[model samples]
Target: MSYGKKEFRKRLLILTVLISLSFLVLLGRLWVLEIIQGEKYLFLARNNSIRLLPSRAPRGIIYDRKGEILARSRPSFSITIYPWNLSQEDLAETVKEISPIIGVKEERIYQTIEESQSPFNNIPLKEDVDLKTATKILERKLSLAGVDLQVQPRRYYPDEELLAPVLGYLGEIDKDQLQALRGRGYRLGDRVGRDGVERVYDEYLKGEDGGWQIRVNNRGQRVGTMGHKEPLPGNDLVLTIDRQLQQVAWDSLKGRPGAIVVLDPNNGEILSLVSAPAYDPNLFAGSLSQEKWLSLKGDPLHPLTNRAIQGEYPPGSAFKVITTIAALERGIASRDKSFFCSGTFPFKDRVFKCWKEEGCGTLNLKEAIIHSCNVYFYQLGLETGVDNIVDFSKEFGLGKASGIDLVEEKKGLLPHRRWRKESLSRKWFDGDTINLSIGQGYLLVTPLQMANLIGAIANGGRLYRPYLVKRIISPEGETIRETRPRLIKEVILKKKNLDLLRESLFGVVNEKGPSGRRTGTGWRAKIEGIEVAGKTGTAENPLGEDHAWFIGFAPYREPKIALAILVEHGGMGGKAAAPIAKRIFEAYFNSKVGEKKSRKVEE
Candidate 1:
C-alpha cells in the first residue's frame, strides 16, 4: 500500500508540471500576438484578402484673359487589371479572353499579366476610351481575367480653334522620362505634360494622386475603401492674352504661314504669339490615330514650329537701326554724318544693288535709316569696323539668346571674325561687315529679337529681357511671384545721337519727306490717327522663297506696344508684312478696352 501511494504521488507531480508548462506556452503566444506583431499581423491578415486602390488626381484647368476656359478635363472609362491578385494559371486564360474582345493580341496581354509586380489595382488595358466603347466593353461581359473598368479623366480643349501652337501638345511617357522620374512617386502609366504650359509647369499641373485600401477576395476584387490620401487638384492657369485679340490674329493669318509677336513695351510681357497652320491640341490627349499624327507631322507649313521664337531670318534693312546704334555709339556716324548711296556697292567681282534704284546722295545718320540706304551703311560699316559692330550688337541682345520662358529658342546667327574662321574655315573681310550692316550675309535674327531691339530703343536705349509668363498664381489666386520691368543693358551714346536716331524712325511713319521714301510695303499700310514707326525687311532664303519681316512700335509719341511680324515666302516686307501689322494695330487700339486704358507713351 505504501509503494502504490508513492508512485501515484510522483505521477500526480509530473501531471501538474505538464499542465503548468502548457499554460505558460499559451500565455507566451498571447503576449506575442498582443504586443510584438499585433499591428503587423493585422495588416498582413487584411492585406492578404484586401485590395489597395489608387485614385488619380484631377488635371488642372487653363483659362484665357477673360476667364474663358481653354482647356479642361472630362470623364472617361479606363480598363485595368490587377496582376498580384490573380493566379499565374488564370493569367493565360485572361489573355485569351481579353484579346478577342478588345482586339488586342493575346501575347501582349499575357506579358503584362506575367510581368507585373506588387499590389496594383490598375493594370491599364485601354486608357482614354470613348464612353460608347466603354459601355460596350462592360455590357459584353468580355471581362478578361483580373480586368476591371473604372472612371478615368482625360483632357479636353474647349477653344482649340483659338490657341493651338501656344498650348502645344502632350505625348506618351517614353523610357527616357520614365527613367528620369523612376521612384519619385510617378509611375509608368502617369500622363506627364510633354510640351507648352503642361511641360513648363508639369509639377503644378500634375496634382498629387491618392489611394485607399480595402478588404478584397482572393480573386482580386475591390471590397471597400481603406486608407485614403485625397489627391490635390492642380491649379488653374490664367494667361495674359485677350481672347478677342488672339482670335483676330488667328483669323488674320488666313491660311498663309507666318508668325506674330506682340508685347507690352513697358514690361516686356508677351501679349500674344501666333503661328499659322495650327491644329487642335486635343488630338494628343489620347492615342492619336496614325493617320492624324502623320498628317500633322508632315504638314508643309511646319505648324508645330513656334516661329516667333524659333524661326531665324536675315533682318534685311530692318537691321539698319542696329547699325545706326553701333554707328552712333562708335562716333563713326552722326546726325549729319553724310555717306553717298549710289544704290550699289562694288564687291569682289560682284556689285550688290539696293532696292531703291535711285541713289541717295549725302544722307545724314537719320536720313540713312529712313531711306533704308544700303551703300550708306556699307560705308558706315567700314568706318565702324567689324569688331566694333559686333561689340555694339552684343549690347543690344543680338548673337545671344533672350532667355525667354519657352522651349527651343534659337540664337540667331551674328557671325564675327572668330565665327567666320571657326564655322566657315575662312577669314573675315570688309565685304562681310558691309553685308552685316545691311542685315545680310550671316546676320540672322528671330522676330522676338527684332521686337526686343525695338523695345530697347523705345525705352530710352535700355534692353529688357523678353518673357511670356508675367506671374504665376497659386490655387487660391494669390500671386506667388510677380515679374518686374527688368532692363538688361543700356547703350551709352550721346543724347543728341540717340535723339537723331529716334527722329529718323519717327520719319518712317509721320513724315513723307525725301528721307522717308515709301520703299517697302510699310509706306502704304498706315493706320489713321496712329503714328506707328516701323522698319521693313526682305531676306533671301537659301532653301525656299524670300522671308519678309516688319518690326515696329505704335503711337510713336509714347511707345506702348511693340510687334514683330514675319511672313515666310511672302513678297516685300512693306506690302506683305505691313498689312499684318496694321491689322494687329487695329485690333489693339480700336478695341474699346485698350482705348479706355490707353496710358500716354512714356519716353
Candidate 2:
C-alpha cells in the first residue's frame, strides 16, 4: 500500500509538468499569431468578410498616317443591377421603374430577373446608358439598391464610311473568341477587332490589358480598390495608305460600280484601293435599329466585300503582255518578226477575231502590241505551245496570289496541261492553249496581281511584295520595324528586252490603228506633259458582259505608279477604264509636282 501511494504521487507530479509545458507552447503560438503572422491573417479574414471583383482596363486607340483619329475609345456610362438580390415583387417594381427610364419593356426586365441565380451575382443586361439616367437612378438610390453604374471605354471610328472595309471594326467578346483566348489573357466583355487591318495587327493593337482588385460592400457598392495594375496602350501604325488619296479614290467611284488600285511602282506600296458602293461601318458597332440596318443590308451592291483583292477577272487584251514576253523567251518570235492579220487568226477549230477588219498586216512586235493584235498572240500561243506560256505566266506571279496582306486572297487560275487534267478532268487540247494564250478560258487574275505585274515591268523585271503598312510606330512613337523593298523575282529577261517591251507599250498611248483610243474610245484621259504608257482590256464573262480593264504607268522612262481599274459591264478598256487611270495619274501629279489641289479622278 505504501509503494502504490508513492507511484501515484510520482505520476501526478509528471502530469503537472506536462500540462504546464503544453500551456507554455500554446501561449507561444498565440503570441506568434498576435505579432509575427498578424497582418496576413488579418487580410485573409477581411477578404472572407468582403466580396472582391475585377474591372477591365481601357482599350487602345488607332490613328491614321497623319495622326488623325481613326478609332478611339470614349468613356461610356452603363447601369447594371444584381438580379439575384431582389425579391419577385421588388424585382417587378424595379423593372417597371427602370423600363420607363431606359425605354426597355417590363417583359425584358422580368426575363432578366428570372434568369439570374441567387448565390453567384448575375451580370446585368444594360450597356452604354447616358450619365443623366445614372444620375437620376442614384438620386432614387433606395429604389435601385442593387444597381451598379460602370464607366467603361467604347470604340469609335471617325471616318466610318470612308474606310469601313479596310479599317474594319471592333465588337464585344464572343464565346468562340473566349475559348480560343483561354491562355492568351482575354476576358469577358473585351472588345476584339473583327476584320480588315484591325484583324491583321490585333496583337500590336490590343496592348496589355490590366485589372483592378475591387472590394465591394454587401449591397455591391465599391468600398475601395484593394489592388490594381495599370494597362499599356497599344502601338500606333503608320500605313503607306494616303488618307487624301484614299478619299480621292473613294469619291471618284461614288456612283459607279468599279474597283481601283493605285500602287507605287518603285516598291509595292498601295497608295489607294477603292471598291465602290461601300457600306458605313458605324452601322455595325452599335445596336443597329431594324430600319437602319435594313437600309444597308437590302442594297443589291455587295458593299461588304473588298473587291481590289477579291474580285477576279480575265485580263483580256491586257494579258497580251504575258503572251508577248512568253513568245520572246520561247524563241517562237523575235522583236522584228511580223504577223499578217486579216482581221482574225483561225486555230485548229476556233477563230479568234481582232478589233478591226483591216487588222494589222505584217506588223512587227512594237506594232503588234500597239494595235493589240489578237492574231499576233494567237499564232504565238500555237507556235510556242501552252506549257511554255504557263511556265512564263507563273514566273510573272500570275495564277497565284501576289501575297498581299489582305484576307481570303484567291490564287488565280493558271491553266496548263497538268492543271487542266487535274481540275477539269478533261484532256488538254490545242483549243485550250489557244484561249489561254489570249488570256481567256481558264485564265483568271485579280487587279492586285495585275498591278504587281505592271510594277514588276516598271522596275526592270523585279517583282515587289505589295503592302500597305509602311512601318509600325511603338507606344513611345519609335519605329518598331520598317518594311524593306524586296525583289521577289527577277524575270529571265535582258534590260534591252524590258526596254523593247516598254517602247511598244508606250506606242499604245502614242501610236494609231487598233490601239488608238485617244481619238475617241478614251479621249478624255489625255493629260499634258506626263507621258503615260498604258494598255486597255475587255474581258468577256459568261455571268454578264465584259469587264472593262485599264493598266498603266506614267513618266515612261522613270516609271512611278502602276494601277488597274475594272468596271463591271463597263465598255472597252480604252474607252472606259483608261480614262480612270489617266484621271488618277492626273490627281497624283497635280498634288505632287503641279503643286495644285488634286483633281477628282473620273471614270
Maximum-TM-score candidate: 1
TM-score each candidate. Answer: 0.82, 0.82
Q: RMSD (Cα, Å) of candidate 2?
A: 9.0
Off by over 4 Å in 2: 1-60, 109-126, 129-142, 211-229, 287-300, 357-362, 512-524, 594-603
Clashing pairs in 1: 50-216, 213-226, 521-574, 521-575, 522-574, 558-601
Score each candidate by Cα lDDT.
Answer: 0.75, 0.74
Q: Which stretches of candidate 1 lie over 4 Å from their true place?
A: 1-48, 87-121, 138-145, 174-184, 214-219, 288-300, 358-363, 513-521, 592-603
- Candidate 1 worst ten-residue window by lDDT: 594-603
